[model samples]
Target: MAGYSRWIKPEVYPLLAPVGAVVGLMAMQLVRNVYTNPEVRVTKQNRAAGVLENFEEGERYSQHFVRRFVRGKRPEVMPNINKFFSDPE
Candidate 1:
């Protein structure tokens, strides 16, 4: 037990702990941006309702300037052209 104490740096570890925490938070944000759905939202308020649009009015938008080679060209427009139904009132 005495020998193990030599390897642990109680003072240094506490000081550096916050650095590790900040790095983790920044990393999470980066991932979120990269994986964010690049789609034009309809409703703007209700995302769940948009899911239903995919079949009824929504569609997959490669929606970008650079075309995809594997599956085929996605929509030329970016962010996709989302369709929404509004109340006529």
Candidate 2:
């Protein structure tokens, strides 16, 4: 639907590209992981803070993980800065 609208407004194509790429990658990941086919065991750690932090009493726990099958393979842990400070490598 969005693609079809591109013909009416060509400028919308570029804007749609980033969103399309993300959606496509997510869809591919879902299809790949549907059968529990993970080529590698990926371990990741994350820290969370701020207003949305999940806490109970005096204990503070924050971490999240999920299986994803995307076109890109994250073989290594790569840290990226916020978009405001992002730069080409």
Candidate 3:
């Protein structure tokens, strides 16, 4: 490593060093924008909408699965038990 370092000219290194530093700084700013900028906010909103759509799709899938596998078993019907317990006299 030291041998390779010695081959670089001192004058040329200083000029190239700042160019590399500037490039690294700009790359950090680009990464920061992905986490905190409006573009990211919009992307998050779109993702949330997609998740809600998927949830509805999943509900449908579950209903289909139960109907196919349960063999004539239906979802239990509510007995309107609340009506009997309420005071009405």
Candidate 4:
């Protein structure tokens, strides 16, 4: 306790856990992005960009996990609320 107090103040103690948690989460996200994200993996491949390569790259990016997930969901409107207001009864 005495040794720790000399280096770090009591006031800063409460902040240490949260800060550490946030840093840990950030590091985990960085690792995930570097290892698992398609875009990052594609860039890391270090390939020369020819016409076919460019087309393939576009396809890869568009078909990334997030993109595919969002694309699978249907777009939503206000169920004709906008049209109802515009048309007037």
Task: Report, for all candidates in order, the number of backbone clashes.
Answer: 1, 1, 0, 0
lDDT of 3 by residue, 1-89 (tens): 68966877677877887999999999977775665443343565565654243456455544664477776754545435655566455
Estimated TM-score for each candidate: 0.31, 0.31, 0.35, 0.45
lDDT of 4 by residue, 1-89 (tens): 78988999879989999999999999987886676544554562443442343566567655777777778555646747767887887
Q: Least accurate stretch of 10 residues (summed lDDT) in model 4? A: 44-53
Ranked candidates (lDDT, high to low)? 4, 3, 1, 2
Q: Candidate 2 has what TM-score? A: 0.31
Please give the distance, in angstroms, between residue 50's alpha carbon in candidate 3 and its true position after superposition. Answer: 8.1
- Per-candidate Cα lDDT values, in order, are 0.53, 0.49, 0.61, 0.70
Error of 3 at 35 (Å): 0.9
True-structure Cα RMSD, model 4: 7.3
Residue by residue across 1-89, what tens digits does model 2's lDDT show? 99877565877768788998999999986765543333322333221232333345113111213423432664544535443356655
For model 1 the local lDDT of residue 80 reads 38
TM-score head-to-head 3 vs 4, winner: 4
Error of 2 at 63 (Å): 17
Clashing residue pairs in candidate 2 are 29-69
- Give lDDT tens digits, candidate 1, residues 1-89: 88866987677788677999899989976664455444444344755654442532322343323333534654445423332223233
Q: In model 3, what lDDT does residue 63 have?
A: 62
Q: Which stretches of candidate 2 lie over 4 Å from their true place?
A: 1-7, 37-89
> Candidate 3 regions off by >4 Å?
2-7, 41-89
TM-score of 3: 0.35
